[model samples]
Target chain A: MVNLTLIIALPLLMAFTMPIFKMLNSKLPKFIALLTTAFNLIVLSSNFTEIMAAPLILELGGWQAPFAINLYVGPLALVAAFLINGSAFILSIYNLSQDYQFDDKFYLLFLMITAGASGMVMTGDLFNLFVFIEITSIAAYSLTTFAGGSSYEASFKYLIIGGVGSVFLLLGIGFTYSAVGSLNLAEIAASAGLINPLLLQITALLFLIGIGIEAELFPLNFWVPDIYTEAPTAVSGIMSGAVSAAGIYALARIFFTLFPAQQFFNYLLVIGVITLIMGELIAYQQENIKRMLAYSSLAQMGLIVTVISLGTEAAVKAGLFQLINHSILKVLLFISAGVLISAAGSKKIKDLAGLGTKKPTAAFGFTIAAMGILGVPFLNGFISKFMIISSSLNADQFLITFLILAAALIEIAYYLKVVQKLYFEDLEIEVKNTAVITVPVILLTLLIIGLGVYPQLIAEPLEKAAAEILNNSRYIMTVLGGI
Target chain B: MLNFLEEWSFFGGSILLIFIGLYGVLSRKNMIKILISLGLMDTGVNLLLVALGYVEAANAPIINSVNPSNAAAFVDPIPQALVLTSIVIGTAVLALGLALVMKIYDKYSTLNISEIRGLKW
Candidate 1:
């Protein structure tokens, strides 16, 4: 069996040794980072069968559960770790083609962020989760300022908001520990029934607010657009793909395993609806391409949150499916947008006119991504949207079903506007297409279409992931067996 | 009043500190002051975590030759460990925030956050 600890250790070891590689050659760090992520991807894939068979619990320092920190690698965590490592590998390849200052620091921060995200998903302790969150945010904050213009301002704003969010998260962990007298998530959940109802409510709300900031839920997500727009496009892609997915995983794990309150689900549903409407409506007005894509990403996340909030088996399954689709689509959209923006020398939608003719492949990739996000038929998004809508109806949530469909219409409208602009507008400037950028975009586009045509390929795994998420008793038993 | 103070002081005081820090973050325009407030809030959280693990009249969580076996007399070590990690993280964030503030000052020539609106909705 592959040592699951190496999944996090390898990237971190590479990140700390980045300075040595930098001293050897200015161009060596990126390759080393790429190799590390590729290695991590290989290790993770080789352990897929083991993860699917049973949750792998690694007890650090040779201590048993409830006494020492542990890593609970379940199917849900494996799915997220795979996404993080896979996206990092692809993004590293994309990074190799770009020329930027501070190359060494960039790769170092990138690897650290990837490692931190993996730690966040796999950690079995609440305090460990907070530590991993801080690691991810700190690395992300540094990466945001890599461009050294408005990026500094964006990173500062992110630091402030993220700092506040971490405080809340710490407070929630403190409260949970005080109540349950254990820091282990499984132990806390096992003893959750004994906690005071009012205290549980307070802790739940604290966690919701804390993790919601990272998850890009409605009120706390104002930092999304500015950070996404101002940060380097590769950073923006990772932020949208791996970082946001980790945030969603954290939220789902905490809510489902620790505090499965019906009232909280109602709160999640209402907030998700509002976020969906707000994100789409706001995205329609954005003149900048990255900001538009960022808002659209937020709206998709809101839709997923709504599905998961339904708390049904089918709903959670559909939510995970959408999560995977959104990760792939955002990566394609953002990286392609990076290519297009560099080609046009401006991010304004008007400035990008006629690039469809200049770079047809990238333009087509963008169009397909836009269509997939809008849930057009024969797309991966459509399958997930169909599942969520039908599940809502099955749950007899008529008003929610109506609201969701309404949000879908608004989503389609904005995406159509972008697609029309991409293909139908008059050519204003010529664009230079490069192979490095075009290849990843096309590869992700193919993955989207492939999944769309054959949804059954991921159906069984996603079903098991959803089951792993919903079965709190199994999680508890797996982690704290007969303790 | 004494009983109330004794019972609620640590938790209440930490909550008050957190609010004060939040108010500073929202109300203060100076970038350095905002970061200072963030540090204050982190300190408050650390104190709260340590307080949560307090046992009445318990000793520090050290096992010595004299008192090696009585676990109940020692304060919980987990929260202390958590606080230690949190404090290190807090320091790193504070340092990073300060570095960003320095850069923002260098670019804008002012520490007022209201003036740093280079990118907006």
Candidate 2:
């Protein structure tokens, strides 16, 4: 019985209030942000079942379905909400301990990023998705450089790259609208084929490049490492975990709802495989911890793409599960890396040698996250990786499964290399200070392990979500207003 | 002039602009130049969006027409709305890019991306 509108509106309203909190006090904004995200997470998770059962649809401004902005809520969108707010909550806790300036504007931008992403996941219109993408990009560009000097530089590069991506997306959305004469996604999905095929094909390509930028696919991923490395670790946590997940979520929504074409799905398959091979191959060469994680993020996205391209109910299910797990675990890994970098006095993996013995708990969190990502048994990463592989196999996409597994091996290769460096080797230099292991750090560590062990915690809802996404008939009926 | 801009080639040509911009980004070394190249690509894409809704001889969409059915023949205004939003976003990103370039210049004193390898493995 939770009101879905309130959940969606909470973040948007916070965007406005975030700025004013700065006038009151510097820390007020972040404190407000943490409180808001925590509240939204509780509200969304508590009503998770009610919304999933009925899948509440709200039309903005009382405009009728096809013509107005619509908010569509289902288990799929709710899962995205949970992952975003949950990680955002943890990252805010980490931020509370750091002494950074511009706290007000930073948190304001952060709230907008969260709101924009949430809007993308919940919106039912093609045009609205583009609008959300714009807001998300602006917020992301600001936050990417919010760490200051070099951060500004990285944000600049990211802005250019992101700008290109947005244009591609806008062109795609425009073309889709022109062809079908409708901005509603479900309507576009139903009627896209009736439009000129060539135009639709081109639009699909545009959309791919557009979304691909945020998704951190190959070639377009140049901005990712720089942004991740230079930006404040708190913001990077959201970027890798929440902001970035929004990209994959939007990609899934558009592909399923606006242009569910066989030919394009096949293209997705090839492109995804390429990203998988390239992302992993390059990640192995990285020496810097943040850049290494950046490459790993690409590799993870490639796996999500691969699973999604399989385009079966099982494949979609596995992909969704992996997507959530990747977001959560990646955040944990990035934050742990941030803590290590700050404590260890060096960014290079070789510099981090032997420190784990000195700081067991922080390193332990890193160990759990790294092992989970490598699909080591009993870790959350292992469960999702197993599901994606099995789902692809069940769909009889053997070659893709082989490639994904090969990528996983590379994943293990790099993850273990870091693990070895953390445990076995000692830094040639004298040991320094370490980031304090606080309650939030302990909580994140425990959650990663808990979810890793009981993956059914996520899998059950993902099953419902997968079924709902593949339920094209029901989706079309809702948007098209009955047969 | 309006009729000329309304041709199907406009869309095709815009695609070429995107490819050219991509080439610039991939091949260019100067950070500022690469940014310009990105701008070129964005322009091309935005033009394509505007071109998508071009119906020759149509006017700006409004309900001023005496008859209801006649309004269907007017230019599609949806693309115009989309373009406005896209243009605004593009501007924000470009400003952000320039600001970053200024900051990077202050730190590194050079615009050459190749020399900017402080974070490299």
- Top model by lDDT, which number? 1
| Candidate 1 per-residue lDDT over residues A1-483, each given as its tens digit | 679899889888888888899999999998998899989888888888888888889998889976779999898898888888878887888999987698888999999999999999999999889888888989999999887779898888888999999999999999998888998999999999899999999999999888998899989998998889999988999999999999999999999998887998899998888888899889989999999989988988898899899999999999999999988889888888888888888899888778787878778878898889888888898898899999999999999899889888987887787678777887657665454576687678778889899999888778889999999999999998887
**How much lDDT does candidate 2 score?**
0.79
Recovered native contacts, candidate 1? 0.90
lDDT score for residue A119 of model 2: 83
Instruction: Mark the 10 consecutive residues where model 2 chain A has the least summed lDDT.
Output: A430-439
lDDT string, candidate 2, A328-442, tens digits: 7888787778878877877899888886887776688788888878878877777778888888889998899899988888888888998899999887666566445466668
In model 2, which regions exceed 4 Å deviation?
Answer: A428-437, B1-48, B54-59, B62-73, B110-121
Q: At residue B83, give the lDDT of candidate 1.
A: 91
Q: Which whole-number lDDT from 0 to 100 does residue A111 have in model 1?
A: 95
Give Cα-based local distance difference scores for all models.
0.88, 0.79
> Candidate 1: lDDT over CA atoms?
0.88
